[model samples]
Target: MFDYSKLPIRNVLCLDMKSFFASVEAVERGLDPMETLLVVVANKNRKGSVVLAASPKMKELYGIKTGSRFFEIPVNNKQIHIVESRMALYVNYASKVIQILEKFAPYEAIDVYSIDESWICTDGTEKLFGNRWEVARKIRETIYEETGLPSCIGIGPNKFLAKVILDIEAKKNGIAECKYKDVEDKLWPQKVEAIWGIGKRMQKNLNRMGIFKVGELATTPLNKLKERFGVMGEQLYWHSWGVDLSPVIQDWEFEEEQKSISTGITLMSDYGGEDTEIVILELCEEIGLRLRQSFLQCKTVYLGIEYSKDIGGGFGHSHTMNDYSCISNQIYKECISLFRKYYQGFPVRKVSVAVSNLQNFDNLQLKLFDEENQRDLSLSFALDEVKNKYGKHSIFKGVSLFKNATAKERANKIGGHNK
Candidate 1:
């Protein structure tokens, strides 16, 4: 139903590091990443800690994958090496891999999708790198040689096709290519959930509509799909036909005005009563700091609390403030109000704070007589300056001194894992 001749077809390569975290640990210990039975857990000491990554052999033999608890692994297996996650080490390797990609493509042509995955556009580099297949092989081999981490490459005409092919085929074959013409034969036969963006919930929704396969979804009426899923349905229809318009090269330096600034943490242990309030204050501090850094102020504050698994459910509510603010205490005051009103006093395992309905700092009109408001704003900026010059942990609210506050510990982490 789409015109193949009218579409943008460019050489896009999707690259993924094999068992990234576990492989990094294996390589550090002088073990073969593919052959070694290794698992990377969030915390080696915590039995309830989640498995973050597992080597190919570990996954194949023990059925242990990411999200599997530490206790699920086979006990006392001499072949299995369980290691705590070293986010800094993994990030260093990821940076090296990106540098390797930069050797083959310009920085602008490379988009770092995640720590261990990326998309490189090689539209004009075939003459320099031989061909797309040659470039993919060179990239895969060079990454392994330099970082000792195996990689897979999927080549296609755009980002979606490349990523889908990478996830489905390249991981098995090391490298795979899928062109528009190959979509029907190669992609359509796969289940809808196998598509890059479709999850189990989406799969069930499609199943109820009698669209269980990619081809089935592709053949369904666009108007009908759009009627049901709105813009997302139109996107699904186009992706099924291998017609992605997303640019392979992303401009990372571009900054769009943000709608919200937020932060959250999953506590290592459940907190209650006053401890939960302390956590809320820390989160508000983080959100407020982010807002000030971006020169934004928020009109709404939101708090979310997730109870322990045993408790099963929790609450999330937001309150619009009388005025916009980038002050931590102001945000915290609104969040605490929400918490006090909604919290059922169950043990809290996770907490989040957010500020939205943002406007530029320039839009905030100073109240001439409100000296307290003026002083608070001045003090917030002064504190930000101190923290920026020294460090995040260099200066913090007194509430952070509370035993339950994670601000100090989190400042040392990368993505909430050990650095």
Candidate 2:
């Protein structure tokens, strides 16, 4: 581990959104972020729907995770206001943020680490943007003005320390740049989990080894870590000391491949019995609409629910079509069937639909027993075209027509009630 306590660390800036999805929704909806305990959830009423983001105050009260729900909040539990996520809107804001970064820093030398985090190489732009600290502040203010998102930036000698300082201590100190001068007294006191990419599982593993904090991780033996975790251990050890040699690379291609597109919503209230079936039906239609829009066929569809308050604890059930399909009805029917098998009478707070192992619809073989199957496929494609041109929900299936149903409730939450 590289110790920067005495040395001056510079030429690195880590820019991160405070609460990306929730902030975008708040700005769009004209909601006051500081006063509200807002959460970006898949479904407003669902109990254990994934909590994409929340305000800082909410974090202090609830310590929410990605899959936490509104009802789980212990303090002012009734104060939880769930907002349904808008992927398109978030992407739009994220693009603007990237544009601001490009205007302030070299595009290629900037690394977009996540949806809300990016690392910019400030080595060359110091003169133009001013000293490292001034440049970071300018970037932060520019992003805030352009996108209305609060960002805490950290500057260090390398990307690793920059990210560590930003992730760990910047918010507490109200500092823009976290350099070597502040490492021992500032960064080293924080918990190990504060380091980016050091999640719960890794934290647990580290804890078992008697490594509890940043200081402990810094002092742990490299040979022991390497023996236990291989290359990842080595990286983690180096990360503890804020030693990151990885260059900020531009043109970083995202790894997601879209064979089928799907979304989920957690209800503000839990549902069982027939209501659960209705939610499943709504998810099927949503997935079906998305599938046709992308011009893909999926042989597998899954319905997942998280009834637990804790993260990473849930059961998912999936069904695969032996014959394979692009037809929405087929996918929907199979999805419902799978749900029936998995429901087990447990109250569901969240519902999700996903289609995987996709194939091009043009290559789909026509069925011999069902003459209408091919016709149904064409109709689905036509409907997809209409929805794509007019906007989603302009046309919806009859099954989802019920007013104030789970689908509508979740949509309102995601669409945001204000804007």
Candidate 3:
């Protein structure tokens, strides 16, 4: 019962590259990106390392998919090629792809969602580029021709529709469109899970309510949905109608401010209790610096420890405070408390920490005991300036000299994996 006549009808294209990482690797090796069987892993030497991407043929023929471990990949499959991740090379290719996209739309109209996907608004470009369909086809062809990255294009009147169509339909057809007029026919028949935002847990809840299809959820009372999912339920209802008012302006930086700051590391080797605490202290500094970098303070701190596979079981716990903070030592105190309370003393292979329930640093109130707090804040600010001007490792923690320290190793990596 929403007013369809009043909604803006813009031509948005959500573009996704097919098996981006694996395809890029295949093309780099002079293999047919479409026909080749390849898998990208962080460390091929580590048998348990997860696969980042798998080529189409590998998925179709061998059932090997992204997230499958190295050992899970069939060694008997002589056709498969295993390659280590090269994030810098892939990012360079993505930048070149961005240059190609700029030909059709300006930077403000483009939103790069991730390493492999983007949304471009071609609202008024139909005058110069023929039509939206033709523009999509041309862009798809131009990308494959110049960079050898096969792409799928999903056309819609808004960003959400474009993304869903790209994820659900264009993935099968290479290029497809879902209009507001066609939402009933195009989006309703799919399983609830197939809709972009409805994950397994939500789908399960909907199933309990006898809502197995998109149409059922759409038709359900707004109050019912809001009761179950709060504001998100309202969003789902509008999304079900293929409605989105957001612009494609790379708004992610400004629109989604940091709600939390965190850092985690999987130790190359198992760590004992004392060594784990030292690593946690180092991680606290990293997290606190990130909070300061973003000008955020957090009221809740989270700690997670994954025991070595041989030991089994892991624990995740959190501590919330009335006072918001972004100081490293204060954060370290909470993390250590949580660690001691729940840690089973098993050999730990991985450790993680996060601070959330955020507030701006500008809003942080000065404490009654301002003398020590000011000194700590001043020292941290000075260290941040030094690191920003020089290099990250320009200054190092004394504990970094400790045997179990991962700060130096992580500084040299990209997203905790080899660069």
**By lDDT, is 1 or 2 better?**
1
> What is the C-alpha lDDT profile of model 3 across 44-141, one tens digit per residue?
88999999999999989888888898998887778889999888788889998999999999888988989899999987788878688999999999
lDDT of 1 at 211: 93
Model 3 has an lDDT value of: 0.88
lDDT on C-alpha atoms for all candidate structures: 0.90, 0.73, 0.88
Tens-place lDDT per residue, model 2, 34-62, is: 55677887656666556777877788777
Candidate 1, 272-384: lDDT as tens digits: 96899999888888888888888888999889999999997998999998887788889989988899999898999999888899997663364441788789988888999
Q: Alpha-carbon error at 167 in model 1, in Å?
A: 1.9
Stretches of candidate 2 off by over 4 Å are: 1-10, 17-95, 106-116, 144-150, 172-186, 199-208, 226-232, 245-247, 252-262, 305-317, 341-347, 363-370, 415-419
- Could you tell me every candidate's TM-score relative to the true structure? 0.90, 0.71, 0.80
TM-score quality measure for candidate 1: 0.90
Descending-TM-score candidate ranking: 1, 3, 2
Where does candidate 3 clash, by residue pair? none
Q: Give the worst 10-residue stretch by lDDT in candidate 2.
A: 410-419
Q: Give the candidate order by descending lDDT.
A: 1, 3, 2
- Judge candidate 2 against the unseen true structure and give its global Cα lDDT, from 0 to 1: 0.73
